[model samples]
Target: KEIVGVTRDITEQTKLQKALEEERDRALLYLQAAGVMLVALDQRGKITLINSKGCEMLGYSEEELIGQDWFNLCIPEEERDKVKMVFEKLMDGEELPYEYFENSILTKDGKRKIVAFHNVLLRNQEGTVTGVLSSGEDITERRTAEEALKRLNEELELRIAQRTEELEAFTYSVSHDLRAPLRAINGFAQALFEDCGEQLDEKGKGYLKRIQEGGTRMSQIIDALLNLSRISRGNLTLSEVNLAEIARSIMKEIMEQEPSRKVNFLCPPRLMAWADARLIQIALTNLLHNAWKFTSLKEEAVIEVGERKEGREKVFFVRDNGAGFDMRYVNKLFSPFQRLHKAVEFPGIGIGLATVQRIIAHHGGWIRAESTLNEGATFYFTLTKGG
Candidate 1:
């Protein structure tokens, strides 16, 4: 009977040992597969255990990380003394559940990474303080992105401030220096027309009229420049805008200005955008009016306003079979007072395109033109995708 009992006891002991070893292996696998880094340190700040993630974050091997001085190996030199003091406090019976803090860790490659640590005091079975257990999250990428965004915002603000000052100077020059001489010239020409009308010949009278007309055109140009400046400095009110509706409204105004012209304008039913309503209306008006003026000589003029998908963006374009300009002068198309057509061909102050460009740029969008002489011209643009 005693011999049989001894054999049975040995079999039971072997099964228990096997089960314990399997459970230990499962625990180690779970630690290795954990997302956040896991580390254990002895009371002397020496690393007792470090998982694979912890080793990877430190840029070291498991053999190199384990049993190394945790404070000296991982903590940056300037911060090591402060961290060591806190570690010592935790070992000396601190009752805190966890200490949450952010600090830089030195890597094996001599670079530093930011880590947010959740540290807890470890204890023995007898409830005596033994060491510390830490779970660290690598926040290097997040911190880098935040820093980049901060710098970008700062630079943008500085640029805005400088631009505001420059706009102020431009406004003063246009208002005072430009308008002052224009008023005097217009006054003198009118005085000649009234005071010396009988003595002046037909040609001399024509000169006076021309001088007055020139002054008026100059005033109009000045007003257009002021409008452009306003667009640059104004605050934006963003909302859902219907491009088709805006185009239709602009065409109506154009038809009213010249009731005899017959033009076919094509616009989709529900082309939409997210932008400032007033600014977008101004842009559409300028583009459509430009098409109407250029197509005056054409017996049958066609204008289309619509959107098409290009890559991940929706590009909106205005196409017209009008007096298309040369591609060589395309670079000058959006400059203020830079005219491609002679005054006899199409009368304009040349600020329309520059105004359109300013509005588009303010909306965080870009504009481009494609044209070949006498064929057609297309202006394509994209709105700011995200704010």
Candidate 2:
């Protein structure tokens, strides 16, 4: 009976041992499978345990890392003292300022990598602090990318500031230097026309008139250029703006200027958008004026200002029954000084659409035109919601 009892006891003991070994193996497997580096340090700052990821990151075998001084081996020479101090404080039962922190570690290849670590204190069953267990993620690549982006942003800001300064200088020259000569030319031509009218014949008077017209046209172009420059550089003040009201006001001004012309203008009762109010006013005015100008030759001129929903976006448009151009030239439509029609026919300096495009772009919006030659044209634009 005693021999049988001994054999049964041995068998049960063997089974219990096997079960403990299996549990340990499972725990080790989980640590090895962890994506981040898992490390455990003893009270003396020696590595007690390290996972496969920690071994791979340090370029060392588990055998080499185990029982090694963690701070002296893995930490960079410059940071070793600081890191060791923190470990000592933790061992002394001081709470760390942060449970999560970042530092640099030395690699086997003499390279340094940034690590973001989340650390916790390990304790014995007696409630005494034993060591620290840490899970660290190598953030070298991410930190490098973020630093590069910051540098690039700084460079871009510098370039923009320089460009703005240059633009201001150019604007000043145009406002003073160019306009001075232009005013002189127009003033002299007017004087010649008034004073020498009796001495001048029809042809001479016609020449003087043409000179005056040329000077006036130049002045208008200079003003347009200044406006374009101003639109390109400014802080945007976004607000809720009634686009329909602005369009109606612009049309009213156009009608008053040309009261003899009969035209049909249609605008919705209300069309609202979130954008820079002044900028939107400028854009709408240009679009409405273009519509009125293009449809002047038509006996039944029809111009409409309206809005519609395109998916989640609100699309506002100006439609006109006018002399539209070929679709092929649409690419050049928004370029400054690019005109599809002759100046005599269009009577514009061709900067209107370019200005409109800049204003739309500033609002984080886009504009497009659709047209069939002599049929009609519609200009559609969408503003970024909430500006």
Candidate 3:
């Protein structure tokens, strides 16, 4: 009888010990969770338990906080008012629940830290508020990041404004000051040739002609550049546009200008678009004209205008069998005065593509180009559905 009673007692003790171990393990696991910093402070604001995150946040070890007064860390002599309201609420029997407060706390190394405190009332089994449990989250990194980003944005805005002013000044100088001298050079050269052509040799006459051509080309380039600049700051007058009609008009104009070149323009019968009508016309004309000029060497020049639904995006491509540039030059293709072909071969200021890109971007669309040397080039872009 005695042996049996002892075994029974041993079994009960074993079960009780197992339950205690399980409870301890669970408490440890709860404290290990990263975001939640479990803490326990007594009625006197004395520190009882500080979890891993709590210690890490206050930049201290649990050894330092335990048994120390927690409120002393928060309410400095000057800022004791921080908790005066908290105490008032507690005295009112209104269990002051989780409240957010930001303050500095002294660390194990005797350094102060600014942390966000989320304090909640901890009650006993009798349903009486016994102590406060606070969660501390260190937001130093986040604050630093936001401050840096704000500074960067401010700097970028200032730089952009300065750059815009510089561009306007340059444009004003180029339009008025630079053109006047070029006009004089060309005009004086023409007069010189008209009066002195009879006394000049073939080479001399050719030199004068070259001077006139250079001045004329330079003027055309200036106009193209100015047009590109206007695209950025100009208000777009949007309207519905029939891309097929625009393509046909551009094709006819090109054909009339260069009738000897055999060019085929395949515009889908029903392709319509929503854009600035005049701007769209200009963009399409430039693209079509570009394709025509690039393919001047090919006996069979072909250009296709078509649209397709790509994933959630609507894409339109202008494909041509032309003297395409190397793909490596793609980045430069949309920059002002950036060209792959010599100005003699392609009579452009290289601002056409830049202007086209600007218009497409203003419509909240993107443009891409694919090409290979001597093969062909295809330019793809998107258009907004309606104005």
Candidate 4:
């Protein structure tokens, strides 16, 4: 006993206690500097502790907020009663499953702010409810931005609808008012050819024929424009379409139109697409027909319809060994009434590719062409799924 009573140095124990207290102070300082607002309220709903962020959010100093009644001091007047009732329930130790809610708070400057809060019940080791610990975020800016975006989208849609209606009316006027005159010019030219062949020489007859052809070509352009407009205005009926079947059917009709041309057509057995059937038909018809027309000069021509992947996207292509174009002019390929080949060399008013572009755009897709002079051309397009 005498040996055990000898004096023992307690300096190490005091140093360890001091280190622990310093670590706890550092942790509290970090919490106070946290970006999120943090607060603790005693069972009576009086503020027990509030971090620096919490005080900044309410525009108050710690001295002013601590020991203050939370519901009465911080909560907006409109929400104070409801918050007090909920506070009472929490104090009564009601078993709540993780409370999270949004409310407006009145800052010390009398300005209001929307706060989204997540709350946890503080309990002692014996499971006795002691207070409430809450973390909050200021959501005023985010909510305002979301509301502004919603309004902007609605306004944009209304403007688009109005513009589309005006465009439709203008297209109708061009189709009706202009077509009747073209028909008359074509009719008169044809009548001249039929009734006055004996009175005119070869050059006059050729001129009349040119007039008739030009009028007919104009009419075809008008029809193509109408078709293009309709594709944009029509309501899309989206469904799974067998693209290969459509290609084969179009090939059959094209072959019948020019039986003497030696052209080979190949397509996959079951190429599929998600698109409006009618619109897709028009697009494919233009592409395939373009291939057929351009390949007319070649003694042996080949055309293929297939789909392949570019990166992660599925790109459908119409390929041909025909008279391709100079890549320099590719920029104008999809423009209405723009042609790379001479009208005499390729029989078209140049609306086909434009129509195809409109159809692809309506389906939220893109189209491109690759060609080399005298070698061949390939057209690639993408149609979005379920678009």
Candidate 5:
């Protein structure tokens, strides 16, 4: 007990323990921090230190970055001279803490990283700029995500093309196989009504005639389905086209689709556009046919085709004074296989407007419809100026 009572100096040991504790805390922070990359450059702008986070941000190991000239290692060669100039400015007691957004940095992995930097100058006691301390942030992932999204959209378009081709093949098979049997039945029924009319009563003759008519109607639908498929699968050959000529041609086509109906087509002459003439003609034909079909109850049908300017864009409209539909169902108007009227009344497969929408999209444009029940309807589309 007497020996243990001897006095001892413990100051050095206590200080050493505190220093060790601080070092351990720093190591823990280095392990946990994912902050903006931290790097320090000496007065000559040589990298004196790059923390763990910095190495990870630039896809480099610590050993590769340390002792390397930070500017030469990361910046583009052309920009290195400017960086040296900036470093000289910093050493001359000038400082810059901010720069523009969306600058690029060459990463160790050979891929470019978009980065933004903020820096502070370290000073000595005599107020000399000794070095630079920088905090850099990486925006590569965001840029990569944007590029990937763009490619995904392109892939989606290609996939749609492939699917449409497959549907066309299926449609061909259905059109051929389905119409053949229907044609045979219709032919045999007509033959019975003509060549064997004396063997059947008036009711039997009426039954045969109804069978032929129903078969003929079904065959007409099959043919319409094929035409609708053609509209969707056709390739767009974009060029400068006159909308007035397209409208005139569409009026003629619609008249052919329904020869008995009287349709008044009004369109301006020499209206110009940048789109595929064939695709636009198809879209116009569909719209005009719809106008004529819906206006069968009216004695006079009025259809107008024209363009209007709207805020750095041009909108073209196909307006009709005919039977319209409810606004509540407008959302489904351009959807494939959706119809506002019954098959018996409208006599279509409901793919016409969908085809028109696809054509507009191919031209980097958009279309919308506005209508009210028992009133007139208008279909509007916009073709971008530079697409």
Candidate 6:
């Protein structure tokens, strides 16, 4: 009976030892598979175990690293004392200042590398701290890239500010200096037609009329340029604006200008958005005016202003049955002075869509257009709270 009992005890002990060995093998496999460095140190800050990644990062083999003084060997001489003191205090039951931190370590090749480490205190069965287990990731390349990108962004911002100042000076020149000569040209042309009317022939009068028209058109173009420049320079004052009301008012103005034109304008009630009210009004006016102008030849003209949901985003759209443009030229639609049609066909300086785009961008929004030639066009936009 005693021999059978001893045999059973030996069998149980063998099974338990095999289970422990399997668990240890599995743990070693996981440590080796880890991408980041995994390291364990004893209470005296001597390396107890280190994974393959840790050995690779330190430019040493696992056999050379185990049982070595971690701070004296891996840490820089300047930081060695401070790091050792902290580890000693942690093993003596004091809490660490931080569980995660970044520091520089010396590799075996004598190069310094930045490591971001997450550490935990390893404890015994009685809850006494045994040592520290740390997982460290090499972040030297990422930190370097981030610093370079930051400097690049600062340089870009400085350049943008300088360019804005230069543009403002040019705008002032166009507003004051250019307009003075333009006014004189228009004034003298009108004087020539009025004062010398009886003396001049019909051809002379026609020449004066053409000169006046050219000066007037130049003034209009200047005004449009100034308006486009101003759109990008201002601070936006945002409020809850009723887009439906603004659309209705714009359409009303267009209809009043050309009372003979019969057009159908449809706008939903209570369409609201958070935007700069004045800027939004200007954008809507431009879009609706374009729609009204293009639909002039349509016998059954229809324009609609409304909003719809695209997933979680609310998109507002201006749709028109008008003399729509070709999709191939849509890429140039929002560029200033880029006209898809001739000036005779569309009496515009071609700054309207560009101005609308700037306004929408200021409001942290975007705009896009879709059209089929001679069929219709739709301008979709989204507005959010402005900065």
Give the best candidate by TM-score.
6
Question: What is every candidate's alpha-carbon RMSD to the true fold?
Answer: 10.2, 7.9, 8.2, 6.4, 9.8, 6.3
TM-scores of all candidate predictions against the true structure: 0.63, 0.63, 0.67, 0.69, 0.64, 0.73
Candidate 4: TM-score? 0.69
Alpha carbon deviation, residue 218, candidate 3 (Å): 1.7
Across residues 205-271, which tens digit of lDDT does each residue of candidate 5 receive?
8888889878887787788667656665656677888988878877886688778877788899977
| Model 6 Cα lDDT, one tens digit per residue, 1-387 | 355443345888899999999999999999999999999998888999999999999999999999999998999999887777777777777666757778889999999989998889999999999999999999999999999999999999899889976886688566767888999899888887778878988898888888888999889878877777787678888888899999998888889988998899999888989988899999999999999988988998999999999988899999999999999999999998899988788788888999899899878899999999998899999997642
Deviation (Å) of 307 in candidate 6: 2.2
* lDDT, candidate 2, 1-387, per-residue tens: 355443345888899999999999999999999999999998999999999999899999999899999988899989988888788877877757647778999887878999998889999999899999999999999999999999999999899879966976697566657988899999999999889888999999899989998999899888888888888588889888899888888899999999999899999889988889899989988999999999999999999999888998889999999999899999999998899999888799999999999899878899999999998899999989365
Ten-residue region with minimum lDDT total, candidate 4: 89-98
User: Tens digits of per-residue lDDT for model 3 on 43-129?
Assistant: 776889888888776666888789987767644555556665674465344654637766655665666556677777777798777
Query: Candidate 1 or 3, higher lDDT?
Result: 1
lDDT of 1 by residue, 218-327 (tens): 88988887788788677789988899998998898888988888788899988889999999999999999898988898888999999999897888999999999999
Give one digit per residue, the lDDT tens place, for model 4 in 1-387.
355556889999999999999999998998888899999999988999999999999999999999999988999888998877777777677636438778888999899988988888899999989999889999999988999999999999899879977886688679868898998998888888889888999999889988987888788878877777777887789999999999999999999989999998999899888988999999999999999999999999999999999998889999999999999999999998999999889988888999899899889899999999999999999999474
State which candidate, 4 or 5, has the greater TM-score: 4
Stretches off by above 4 angstroms in model 6 are 1-35, 39-49, 56-137
| Candidate 2 global lDDT | 0.90
Q: Is candidate 1 or candidate 6 better by TM-score?
A: 6
When 3 and 5 are scored with TM-score, the better candidate is 3
Clash number for each model: 0, 0, 0, 0, 0, 0
RMSD of 2: 7.9
